[model samples]
Target chain A: MKKFLGAELFFESLYDLGIRTIFGLPGGYVLKIYDVMPSYSKKINHVLTRHEQAATHMADGFSRASGLPGIILCTSGPAATNTITGITTAYSDSVPVLVFTGQVPTPFLGSDAFQEADHIGITRSCTKHNTLVRKTVDLPKAIAEALFISNTGKKGPVLVDMPKDVLISESEYKMPKEVKIKSYSPKVPLKNSEYESFRKVLTASKRPLLIFGKGACSDFNKKLISKFLNKSKLPAMSSIMSLGLIDGTNKFNFGVVGEGGSAVSEDLINKADLIVSVGCDLIKIVPESNLKSKDIVVVNIDKANFNARTKGNMNIHTDSDNFIEKLSAEKGLSFEWEADNLQKLREKYLNSQEKEAKTNKRAGIFKLISNLSPKNSVFCSDFSYEDVILQKFLSVSDFKDSILSGGNGTPGYGFPAAIGATFARPKSKVISISSGINFQFNMQELIVTLEQKIDLTIVVLNEKKNKQKKYSGPDYKSLGESFGVKSHQLSYNDKNFENNFKKFFNHKGTALIEILI
Target chain B: MRHIISILVDNEPGVLARIAGLFTARGFNIESLCVAETEKPSLSRLTLVTSGDEWIIDQIVKRFENMINVIKVEDLSGEDSLERELIIARISTNQKTRSEVLRVADIFRANVVDVGPKSYALELTGNKEKLEAFIEILRPLGLKEISRTGLISLKREKKKITER
Candidate 1:
C-alpha cells in the first residue's frame, strides 16, 4: 500500500464518498488541510464562509436539499464553538452533517494550548457520535465511520476532531472496504408479523389517517408515499417539518398537525380511528387528554424514538421508505376512509384563510408570494411571525419544497440555507423568506451569495409598528445594497405589486426584495 | 421499580463521564454505579442502579443502546441474575460493646478487618438485603465512617444437573 498523509486521506475519502462541495473557514490548526487544498482543488470545492456558524448552516441546508450528508470543516476552540448552534440545529432536525474540526497536537491536547478545545466532550449531547483521532492511521476509518453514523438511521450531525500532528503524519493508506459498528445499526429488519398487524389495523378502520413527520421527510420516499396515500385514498397530514411530503393539491392531504396547524386538521386527527404515523414520534399529534382513547401505529427506523409520547398499539421497526414500499406493494390493502366530510372541512378552512388574508396584511403578503412562486421553487423560512404565515398559505409540491428550521428553530437559517439549496438545485429557483429583524442575524452572508453568483431571491417582511417593538427596525434594502446585491423596496398592496415582485423574483442572479406591510 | 442496567462499553477516556452526562442530560439520576474492566481488557462493564416505572426504564435502555461506544446493554432488573455489594464500615466501640460487635459480625459472616482503640472496622459482602440488615445491626453499635462499593451484577448461567 502506498503511504499518504492524513490530510491526503481525508480529502480522498471525502472525494470517494461523492462530496463535491464543502463549507468552512480556515484557521491556525486547520491550516494543514487548507495547505493541501491546491492539489485536489478540482475534486473538492470549498466555500470560505464568513463565519463558522454560517458555514454549518450552509452545510445543513445543503444536506437537507441534496439528501447527502453536509460537510463542514473548521479549526479548534472558538471556531469549533461557533458551529454549536448550527450543529445543534442539524441535530434537532436530524439532518445528516459531517463536522470536521482541527484540534491542537495530541501532545498539547490536555495542556490548554492556544486554539484547543475538547470537541468530543462539548459536542457529546448534540451529536449522534463523535471521535478524536489520536493516530494518523485512524483518520480514514474515523472519517468513514463519522459519515456512516451521520447519514444513516436517525440521521444527525457527527464530528471528527483531528489534531494537527495527526493530519501531517504519514501512514499507509488503505480504504476501509466496509465500515460497521457492532452496536450502531441504522436499519431494523421488517418482520412479517408486525407488517401483518399494521396492515390489519390499516385496512379495518372506518376512518384512518396517515401522518408524515421528519422521519418520512426524504426525497426518495416522497413518490412512494404519495402513491401509497393516493392508492389507499387515506387522509394524510404532515408535521411542520414535513410539510411537502403530500402535495398540497392531493384531495386527501391535510396541512400541518402541530402548533400553528389548521383547526380542521386537528379535528381530523381527533376523529380518525387508526393513525399510522410514519417516522413521527406523535408528540402533540394526539392531545394529551385524548391519548388514552387514541389508537396509533408508529413506524420508525430507530426504536429509541418510540417512547412514552410515541407509544402505540403496534410499533414497526422499519424506515419510512421501506415501510411505504412494503405497504404499497401488498395488493388488496385498502382503507375505507370517507373523503366527503374531509373535503367540506378543508374547503371551509381554506375559505376562512382567504377571508383573513383580505384583512391581515402579513397574511396577504404571504398569500401573494405563495401564488406567484414558480413550480418546484424551494422556500427556506427563518423563525419569525412570517414563517408560520408562509406555511399557512404556501403550497408545497414535493418533499423539501418548503424547508423550515424544523428542530432547532434557529434564527437566520433562511438565507444561507437558500444559498445551499441553490447550489444543490441549481436549475430550480431558491427563495428565502424572513422578517426584517431575523434576517439581520446572518445578513453578512449576502456577500457570499453575491460572490458565488447563485440564483436566489430573498424576501424580507418589514412589518412596521409590530406588536413586538424590538423586532420592528432595520432597513433591509440599504443593507442589501451595501453587500452589492440588487435591492428593491415595495408594499404588498401596491397597485403594481405583481409586476414589481416578478421583476426581482425572475432575476437571473441574487436579489433581495423588502416587502413593507 | 428499581432497575440494574449492565452495560459493556469500549474502555476509553471520558467514557464514564459521557454515560453520566447522558443521565444528567435526560434529568435522570444514577442512584449507584459500579464500573471496572471485565475479562476482555479493552471493554469495561458498568452497572448502574436506578428506580423508575417500566416506561422510564425502557427509555433509559434505549438511550444507552443509541450511544456509539456502548457495546451491549442489559437491564438485570427482575432477571435471573446474581447481585453483590461490598461494604466497609467503622463502628465506634467500647470495652462493653466490642465483644457484642464481634458476635454480630460472626453471625453475619463479616470479618473484623481492623480493631482500633476507639472503633472496629468490619468488611462485609452480600446481596442488598443482607448488607442492609448488617448495617442496621451495626448502626446502634455506633457506626461511624463507611464506604461502599455499589451493586455489581451478572446474569446467572443455565446449567442442568444430573442425579448423583
Candidate 2:
C-alpha cells in the first residue's frame, strides 16, 4: 500500500513540477506542512519573508525571470488576505503563479473557527481558478489542477486552500500522470494560412513597424523574435513587458512604446503605415496610439478570434512564436525603399538619448549604471515615477531580465521581486531599484538576503531637502548593517561618492546603495 | 437611460456576492435584481436593472462578462424584449373604498389575494409603468407595504440556446 501523509505528498507534487523555491510565512494551520519542509530543504529553498504579501511578490519576480509559475504558501486569515495584491498583480499582467493557503480544519469551516477566512470566495474574482480542499484524497489532484490552470493558456494566478485536518489525514497516494482542465485548451502551432497572410501584409508594407508585448516574453518567443527581426530587417520597439526580451542597444530597437514611453518611440508609431502587434495594445492603451484601425495587425493566441480593441482590425490568432517562425522561414526579407529611414531613425534616437543622459545626471544614476555596468542582469522596480525614470534611462537586453509589477501601481513589489529574481539566476547580478519612500514598504525582506548571502544590490533613491520636507527616516546604511549586509550611502556633495560606488560593487555578498538626489 | 442586463453564471456559492459586491463597491446603481436557477441545474440567470449612459452600461456589461463563473451577459434593455414585474401591496380598506379598489384592480387585471377586515392584499404583474399607475390610484385607499420582484426580460427574437 502506497500511503503517505497528505502534507508530504504536496511537496512531492511541487518538487516534481520543478519548483525550486517556495516563498512563504509560517502559521498555526500550516505547521503540519512546515514540519516536513526541512527534510526537503536541500532540494528546495524556502525564503521566509517578513510579510506574506512580499512572499507573493518574490514568487512573481521569480516567475517573470524564469518563465515558470512561482509558488507562494501562506497561512489562513490575514496570511491569505495579504496575498490578494500579489495575486491581482499577477492576474492583471498575465504572469503565472500558484498560491497555497492553509485553512482552519474542515469541520470548522463556515463556523468562523480560529484563523478562519473564506480564501476561495475572497480571491475568486482575481484568480483564474481556485478550490477549497475538503477530502484529503483530493489534495494531490487539486494541487496538480491548480498548477495546470495557472501555467497554461493566457497564464494567471491559481489558489488552493488546504484545511489543517486534511493535511493530517491519510490516503493511498498516486502521483497524477497528467492534469487536465476540460474547459481550457490553449491554441498551439497556429494554422499556416494565418501566418502566410500576415507575412504577405507585413512584407508588402514600405513603412512597417513591429511592436512586441509581455506575451512575447516567453523563452520560445525570444528565439522567434531575433530570427524574425534578422530576416525582415524591421525596426522594433517593446511594450513595457517585452523590455529585455529584445536587445536595447540593437540599432533596430526603439525603447518601450506606450503611455510612459519616449518621444522617439511615439514619433515612430505615428509615422509607420503598418503596425504589427504581437499580443499588445489590445484593450486599454490603444487610445493613446491614435493609429488608424486599418493599419494594425494583432497576432495573438485566440485561434482566429478578434481582440477586444481591434474588433474590425486584422487579427490572426496563433502562437506568436510559431507564427513568426514560419513567417521568418521564407529566405529572410529585406526591403529597399532607397535608403530606408528605419536604420536612420534608430541612430537618431540613440544619439539623442546619449545627449539627454549626459545632461541629466540627476537622472543619470539609472543611466550610468545601465550603460556602464560590466555585467547585464535582471532589474525590478515599483509603480512609481521612479520606474518611469528607470525605464527611460536603462537599456534593455534580450539576454538579461527585467520585472515590472505592470500597473498594479502598488509600491511594495520591487525589492522582494529582485531577491526572487536573483534566486532564479544566482550567479548573475540582480538590481532592485526603487525610491526611498517606496523601498520601505517591504525593506524587512532584506533579512532573507542576509540568511542566503547572495550577490544582490538594492539601490534606494532618496531626495535631499531643498528647504522642503526633511528626510526624517532611519539610516538605510545602518539598517543594512543591522541585517548583517554591507551598505553604502552616496549623495551629490560627497567628493569620494563615485569611488565608493565602485568599491561597493567590488564588495561581495548582499549590498545596499542609497543615492541621495 | 435604464438598462436590464441578463447574466448566466455557474450556480456556485459566493458568485452572487461577487456580482452584487462589484456593483456596490464601484458605486454603480442597481434599481432592481431578480435571480433564479435556469433550466440547467448547474447554472443560474441573474437579471439586474440599472440606469446609466451608454458608456457606463458598456463598461458594466463588459466587466460582468469578465467575471469568473459568468457564462454570458446579454443587455436586453436596447433590444425588443418582453419585460414583466410582480408587485404585491397591502392597502388599507374600508366600506367606502373596498368596492372602488376592486373596480380599479379589475381595470388593471390585478388580483386580490387576501382580504383582512381593514386591509386587502393586492397582486399585480405588468410593466413598471402599469404598476406605477396602479400604485397612484391605490394611494387614496391608504397603501401600506409593498414587495416587488424587479424587472426580468428576454428578447422576443427566436434563438437557440447559447453554449456555456
Candidate 3:
C-alpha cells in the first residue's frame, strides 16, 4: 500500500512545518481536506468561520502575533475571492500567511462552473506567490511552496488554489524533505561594503536617530535591536506599526512620528544627522512632502526602500538588524555635543504631559494590557481611530511586545488577527483593540476566538457613531449608515455594556470589554 | 543604487512570475533580472538586480526567504565572493575581431562556448565588470544579440552565517 493518501500527506506536511491551526470555512470542494483534518486534530486545530474573509484575517492575525505563517482554507468562487482583501492586507503589511482555496473541478474550470473563479489570477497581485495544483501528486510540493513563500524574506501571503478534482484525486504522495526554488533566495547578511559604509556614516555623525518599524519587533530582531538601542544611546522613535517594540517609557524613547505623532518625535526625526530606520518605510516620516535633508542618512533592510524618497537623499540598503549589530561593534566614534540647539528643539516639541494623556487609556484598556499581558503577549488591532489612540498610548511604555495592524487601513481586521495572534503566541495573552464599527464588521470572529479556546481580550470601544466623521462632515453619518451602523447603535444606551461584554467572554476563555465613551 | 541578488531556486514554472509580481506589486525597481537553470538539475538561479533602500531590501529578503522552493539568497554586491559566468552568442567571425574578442576573453579568463561560421559564442565569468568589459569588446565586433547569466556567487571563506 502507498504510505500516504493525498489529503493525509497534505496535513502531515503542514504539521511538520509547525502549523497547528487552520482558519477557514468548509464546503463541498474542500470536503476531502476537511475530512482528514480530524485525524490531525490533536496536533492541528481548525477554526471554522462564518466567512472566508474572517478566516484569512485570522491567519493574518496569527502570522503577525507568532512571526510564523498563518494558514487559511476556503472553498471556491466567492469564498476564494473573499480572501483577496485579507491577502492584500497581509501583502501591504508584510505579514506571513498561507492561504489554501478550493477550486471547482478541473473538468468544470472556465465553464462558469458552480462556485468557480480564477483564484490564481484574482489573487496574483495581492499574494507574493500562488499556484493552481493540477495533480494530487503535486499537492505536497505546492503546499510546501506556499508555506515557504509566505514565511520567507519580506514575508507575505501565498495562496494555493486546489481544484476539487486535484483534492479528490487518488495518488501516492511523497513529500519532499526540502524544496528549492531557483528564482528566489532571501538576502540574509549585509554585504561587507554596505556595513562599512554604514559604520563610516554612524561614526561621523554627531546626532543619530533610530526609527524602528513593526518588522523590527519580530522575534528574530527584537533583542538585537534592544541591545543596539541601549548600547548606542541612540534615541529612537517607533513607527505606529512598531509601538511596543521598546519600552515606550524608556529614557531613549521619542514616541511615534507622523501626522498625529508627538511634536517632539517629529522634530527629533527631522533634525537627526543620521537616521537609521529599521524596517520602517518612509510613509510616516514623509507625510505630505519629503523630509530628506542633506544631513539625513537612511539605512534600511530592503533595497527597494533605499531611494523611495523622491528627493535627493543618502540611503544604504542592508538588513536593519544586521546593520545595527555591525554599527554597535564598530569602534572610534565620537561626537561633540550640540547641546544648545538640541535643547531648544526638545523644548519646542517634547510634551511629557501629552505622553501622560496618551497613556491615560492606561486606566482603562491600556492598564489592562500592562497588568494582564503575559511575558509573551501579542497585541493586534483593527484600523480604527481607537487603534491609533491605543498605539499612541502604548508608545510610551516599555513592553517588549508585538503589534499587528492592517497596513492598508482595512476595518474589521482586529478580531480575526487577534484570534490568529493567539494561535501564534499560545503562551501569551492576545489582545484586540477594536471600535464599535469594526466589531460590527466581523462579529463572527468572537465566536471563532472562543471556539479555538484562544486566550484573547477584545477591548471594544463603544461609541454611538463614527468619531472620525465628526470632523469630516455629513458624509460621516452616511458612511456609518452604509456600514449598517445606525445613529442609535452609535450611542451607548444599554447601561450594562461592560457586563454584557463580560458575559460574552464568560465561560468562553475569551474576554470582551466594552468601554463606554 | 541597484543591487543584484542571486538566488538559487527550484526550477519550477510560475516561480519567476511570483518573484516578478512581488517586485512589481510593491513598486520596487527591478533594473535587470536574469534567470536560467544551472549545472544542477531541477534548480535554476535567478539574478535579480533591484534598487531600494535598506527597508525595501529587508522586505524583499524577508519575503524571499519565506518562499518554500528558494534554497538560498545572497546579495553578491555586499560580499567578497566568487563571480559566476554568463554566456552570450553574437555574429562576429572576422579573424581580427575574433582575435580581439579572445584577447579580451583571455584577460577576463573567459571561454569560447561555441564557434559557428559567422558567430562566436563567448563565455565570460566575473562580476558585472569583467562581463561588461567582454561585452564592450564584442559590441564593436557585431554584437547582434546578448544574453547574460545574471549573477552567481559563493561566499569567500571566512565565517558560517545563519539566517535570522
Winning candidate number (lDDT):
1
Residue by residue across B1-164, what tens digits does model 3's lDDT show? 66768777878876777678778777887877778777777878787778887667766775676555567777777777665667675757777677777776677777788898777777766667777777777677788787776665556788322232
| Per-prediction TM-score to the true structure, in the order listed | 0.94, 0.86, 0.70
Can you write out model 1's per-residue Cα lDDT over A8-111, one digit (the tens) per residue? 88899899878999999999988889999999899998888898888999998888777888999999999999999999999988999999999999988889
lDDT per residue for candidate 3 within A273-374, as digits (tens), equals 666677777655556243546345556655556554445456666566666667667555555435566455445444652554545542245544444454
Candidate 1 interface RMSD, angstroms, 1 decimal? 6.8
Ten contiguous residues with the weakest lDDT in model 1 chain A: A283-292
Give the CAPRI rating of model 1. Answer: acceptable
How should the candidates be ordered by lDDT, best one leading?
1, 2, 3
List clashing residue pairs in candidate 2: A361-A364
Error of 2 at B124 (Å): 4.0
What is the DockQ for all candidates, taken in turn?
Answer: 0.45, 0.14, 0.17
Q: How accurate locally is residue A188 in candidate 1, as Cα lDDT from 0 to 100?
A: 70
Report per-prediction Cα RMSD to one decimal.
Answer: 3.4, 4.0, 9.0
TM-score between candidate 2 and the true structure? 0.86
True contacts kept of 2: 0.07
Q: Which stretches of candidate 3 lie over 4 Å from their true place?
A: A288-290, A308-312, A337-377, A395-402, A465-508, B1-164
For each candidate, the alpha-carbon lDDT, in order, equals 0.83, 0.78, 0.68
Query: Where in model 2 is the C-alpha error above 4 Å?
Result: A1-6, A106-126, A171-206, A282-339, A371-376, A465-472, A490-500, B80-82, B103-111, B126-142, B155-157
